[model samples]
Target: MSYFRSVALGAAMSLAGVAGAAAQEVQERTMTLGHVVAEQFPYHTSAMFMKEKMAEETDGKWTLEVHPSGAMGGERDALDALLLGTMDFTWVHTAAMASFVPSFELFNMPFVFHSPEHIEEALSTLDFSKFYEEADAAGFKLIGIGSPAFRYPMNNIRPIETAADFEDIKMRTMGVSAHIDTYEALGSQVASTSFAELYGALQTGTVDGNENALSALNAMRFNEVQEYLTLLPTVANIAVLVMSKSTYDAMSAEEQALVDEIGKQTVEKNNSDYASMDAEALEAMKQEGLKVNEIDDLSSFVEATAPVREKYSQDLEPWVRDLMAEIQELPSAK
Candidate 1:
């Protein structure tokens, strides 16, 4: 009778342990991440990497369902969805974020960073954290910066060889104020349009020119529609990945930490991947029979936009000047 009682007690203890483990395993969370870029795009790839890492870190307790290629909607739409709690996260362009957070327009300022390394360093500074905090206050959690490829010009008109070349051309620009102001200063008519309509807009003569990173041009096959390519590095288009505060706040402390760490890792991977892809895309553009032109007088282009920058300073937050000054002081990129 004593031996039988001891056996029954051992069985009960084993069953209790199994029940506890099952309870822990049932604690799972799901999040939806949206991106405007295609699945093959670097930004989307980085998001996927983050999703995988998040799952691994939490031992499958956390999972992200990615909606790529504008499946959820455009940047603005995705942001609205996030606010409504329909979308948990998204990778939005700085220009897109400008509508929600006016202070973010500072990033669209031309020639903000001299090089990719400088851009990365400036962004990694402590001041950048303040922007994230501000985002949190505004109902979203700014995860980290995703580096889009370098900006260049593609035109159906002539190659942009000089400042005079920009005179009176109709250029399609992202629907952002700074871009409109900058192009207006350059003597071009800026038309705001969505990415989905850009190719048709270019082909149908709705616009004579457009500017974007080489990777984007290649991804969209704009070389087939545009006749000229100019290696004019105008801006470093940065993307910010954000999560809805409602979604983030609902997670446990351990899960939140995992998400934050994954965001940092994804940002670094995106930066590295973009640098390489930008070079490859530029080469591909050259081989596609597009006339590539290198401007001899870049200073003229910069000087022509002085008034625009001054106006941006007046209109934007004081933090813009502070961030710009910090970027200028950083060591040159190798």
Candidate 2:
């Protein structure tokens, strides 16, 4: 009986050792997050914030290595790397995500979100949670949406005061179908171009105008080449942070929870920081002698695109409409 008791004690000791080894193994794993934005960009700041949050939550068991300023690769290349598990995470523009999950194209729909608060509320709602679940099934997991502030029109041709000013103007776009459709609906010829190529396109007259957030215009020095800033509030472009499903699944349940929590915190921080940055950029642009035109009649722009929205409604899945409705119901911060 004493021998039997000794054997039982040995078995328990072995089980405890095995558990300790497994815990140690978990602590050894590292995650690398990549992005195309410069270190000065708000997206990078948010990425850093996420890293700190995740590190604290995991108690140093997991560490995040951030690659900023397009050090890893371009948006498409980074996404491909994530799928292959060579890269663990990244913040990609929604237009870039459309290549993997076509439903993301709906995010490019102009005027879908009226304000930053609306967009944030929609993202935190149940509908977007379901959308993230679907995205996880597609081999990528949504972390959170990066704040893109308000988009405005900048052009070299002429000041855009009305929708009619868009007539015959060739505008550069992110090469997404929805954006192309929106610009075309406004009577402008849309030319799809990469952000890296935009300066040359503008200088060589390949495209006469481009739409982007105020921060991007200032960061990219578009103000140097562009003459007019049309505050049309056309869209709220989003940068979506995502992780490879395989990489995420490799994490223990506790580690997964930490990452999820960090993502939520990062979103709020990004939104608040981006809003302040945008205001500063706007002031700087005004000081630089850029003609800043605020369109009092945005109704003309919205009215002219009514048919465009109708034509594209069929292309949008029912989930998008559900998400939009939820967003509309949220309390406005504007």
Candidate 3:
């Protein structure tokens, strides 16, 4: 009986050691997050916030390494890396991500949101279950999304107080079909330009103008090149944080919960920060000598974009269209 008791104690000790080793291995795993935006962008702040919170909540069990300013590569490359499991995560504008996830084009609908608040309210209500299901099927996971403020036209040539101003203006775009068509429909000659060359393009007359969130515009220092900003039919932006589905699934249940909680906190912080950054950017741009004009007749721009939206809608999936309808009906914050 004494020998048997001694043997049982030895087995229990070995099992406890094995469990401790497994827990240590789980805690030592590192996650890599990549993004194309500069550190000046609020996205970077949010990413770091998420990283810190994750490390704290997990008791330093997981550490996140962030790569900003396209250090890893472009957004598209990051998405590919996520699928290949070379990158654990990436954050990118849904507009740029539309090529990989066509349903994301739903956010591109002009005049769908009035302010960041409206977009957030809709996001809080609209079911993204399908998006996750689809992303998982494609080997990517949609972890969280943030409202990226509103997009408006900024030009060097003239104030776009009216849709007529867009006539004959050459605008740089991401070369997405919907974006190109939207500008063309509104009467701008669209130029598909690289992000790295956008400032040079505006300065050298390669394109007269472009549209983006005010924060992003300032982050790129477009205020240095672009002289005029026309706040028109505001377009909303969604920044999606993506990860490899397999990578997320492989995390221990506790680790996954921590990640999810941190993701939600990141989304909230980024969106609210982006919303406030818009006003700060406007003030900064004013100080930078950019003439800003508010379009009194925003309805005109919306009317002009009607055909573009209709054309794009024709190709969108049914659920995407339904999602668009829901988003358009969300309470406005104008």
Q: What is the C-alpha lDDT of each candidate?
A: 0.74, 0.74, 0.75
Provide the lowest-lDDT 10-residue window in model 2: 12-21
Candidates in order, TM-scores: namely 0.84, 0.82, 0.85
Candidate 1, residue 88: the lDDT equals 88
lDDT of 3: 0.75
Over 4 Å off in model 2, which ranges? 1-26, 124-126, 192-197, 200-206, 325-334
- Model 1 is weakest, by summed lDDT over 10 consecutive residues, at 11-20
Q: Tens-digit lDDT track for model 2 on 1-334?
A: 2222232334221111111223343455678888987787777888888777656555576688999988999999988998899998888888888778867766777776665656756666545665587677778978876674567888888899888999988888766677778889899998877778999888888889898877888888888888899877576678788888898888777567656766767766666567766766777888999899875556777777766666665666788766655665677522
* lDDT, candidate 1, at 317: 68
Task: Tell me how many clashing residue pairs each candidate has.
Answer: 0, 0, 0
Q: 106, model 1: CA deviation in Å?
A: 0.8
Best prediction by lDDT: 3
lDDT of 1 at 195: 72
Better of 1 and 2 by TM-score: 1
lDDT of 3 at 36: 87
